[model samples]
Target: MVGRAEFVSRFGGVFEHSPFIAERAFDAGDVREPMTAGTVHAALTKHFRAASQDERLGVLRAHPDLAGKLAIAGGLTEDSRKEQAGAGLDRLSPNEHARFTELNAAYVEKNGFPFIIAVKGLTKDDILRSFETRINHNVQDEFATATEQVEKIALLRLTAILPES
Candidate 1:
């Protein structure tokens, strides 16, 4: 089994900027050997779910807005950059970019957090459609949806870095 330092170093950003989830999981002795993506994701999700609402919201807030200024400025994390580029977000036309920007603003304004999607196999249009649909959800429902999306993103990231169970 990996020690806490190595474990945290490897998986700290699984929950976006929240290394505390990994630290809390390791400190709780939740992580075990045979750390496949499924096992590690379970451990991390446990701690993430256990975190206070503010902490969870912080995790959500830590995520970069889709096709927003940070992405345009090239300020996303490596995983995020690759994921967005894979979705063709990096190559959006100006009109598509504007739509994304407008939708991102409205989503954040209503939900108090950015739209969160797994975006692994999704196209730009797929994302835009999702954004438009999800924006109409009430804040409470949207928060739950965003939280679930964050977990999905974390799992996808883990799958790339670790073996599946």
Candidate 2:
């Protein structure tokens, strides 16, 4: 078994600034030899899902607004930067940026947290459409949706760093 420190160091940011999830997973003792992306993702997400609503909301809120000021300022995490760039979020036209800004504000105002999506393999247009549609969901539903997206993002991050198994 990997030591707790090394496991946490490798997987700490899988949940977007939520290192406690990794710590909790390690403490849960589910990590075994020959760890794979799938197994790591499952263990991390198990603790994430089991966290309190407030804790989960913190995870959601830790995510930067899609294509917002952070992206403009190059303040996003490396994983987020690459994922957004992959979706063409880094090359937004002025109008597209404006629309994204508006949508981001509206979504955050309606829901307590910023909109979170996996972003991998999705186009900017696809992301915008999802943002527009999902913004209309009730707060409870939106919260649940954001939670799921966080899990998806974590899984993708894990897969990038570990074998699939």
Candidate 3:
């Protein structure tokens, strides 16, 4: 069994700065051994599912828009910076960057939150295309889509951080 601090350290950033998810997981039961990527991901997703609509919105909002201001300001987390870079966000041409900026604004204006996508293994072109398509969804559907994207991000992060068995 692990202590609360250690549990948080391991699982906190799985949800992109959302330590409360880890805390909730630890409180939901004793922190058992052999917490694999799947187990930790399920723990985190349980809390995400239990969150109120407003809380889910906050979690979705915690994410930086792809190639958006946070990346420009260097305010994204180390993991986020690397993930974004991996998605070709860090090497954007001027025109692509402008297109992203425009899409970000339009998406947020329509959805009331940043567009959430798990950028790992995704090309910028894929993300841009998804943005165009996902923006067409109604607000309620968009909310569901954003929440699902957050869960996907958490699973990928968990897979990276969980100790190899």
Candidate 4:
């Protein structure tokens, strides 16, 4: 296995802009396990739980909105671009794109942070439904829910990177 520095570099941005998640996982993982995505995901979960509210919010904010402005501007990170495309977000019909933009605006206006979801295997319809549902939650509950989605997204990204061992 590679040393800690390489491990961190490879996995750091797995959680959007949060390199600290990978660093903490590297520090916490079993010396016996092969540092597979699952193990790092477990370790990262622990660190995420221990993080302050602001730190959690920061990582959530780091994620781009699904098929939102960044995608239009072609500014998303390659990983995000691909993940969104996996669910047909990239080729959205014009009406669907407009709906997403309207919902995204409403969600962010309500929650200060962008809506967060692990849009791996879901359709644009599923994402829109989730956005409609989550937008109604009170701030505290939505904050907790958004962080949970961040953890799930991190695990999914890690899984994408590591081959099964």
TM-score of every model? 0.99, 0.98, 0.95, 0.91
Highest-lDDT candidate: 1
Which 10 consecutive residues of model 4 have the lowest summed lDDT?
A: 28-37
Instruction: Give per-residue CA lDDT, model 2, range 1-165, as digits (tens).
Output: 889999999999999999999999999897877899999998898999899989999999999999999999999999999999999999999999999999999999989789999999999999999998998899999998888899899888988999999
Better of 1 and 3 by lDDT: 1
Give the Å shift of residue 42 in candidate 4.
0.6
Better of 2 and 4 by TM-score: 2
TM-score winner between 1 and 3, please give it: 1
Candidate 4 per-residue lDDT, tens place, 1-165, comes to 667798778878888988897787677653225767787777778887788888888888898988999999999988899989998899999999988888888888888888888899898889889988888899888888988888888888878887545
Identify the superior model by TM-score, candidate 1 or candidate 4: 1
Give the TM-score comparing model 2 with the true structure, all chains together.
Answer: 0.98
Query: Candidate 2 overall Cα lDDT vs. reference?
Result: 0.93
What's each prediction's clash count?
0, 0, 0, 0
Question: Each candidate's lDDT (Cα)?
Answer: 0.95, 0.93, 0.87, 0.83
lDDT of 3 by residue, 38-147 (tens): 87777779988997888888888888888989999999988889999999999999999999999999999988899889898999999989988998999999998889
Model 4 whole-model lDDT (C-alpha atoms)? 0.83
Evaluation by lDDT, superior candidate among 2 and 3: 2
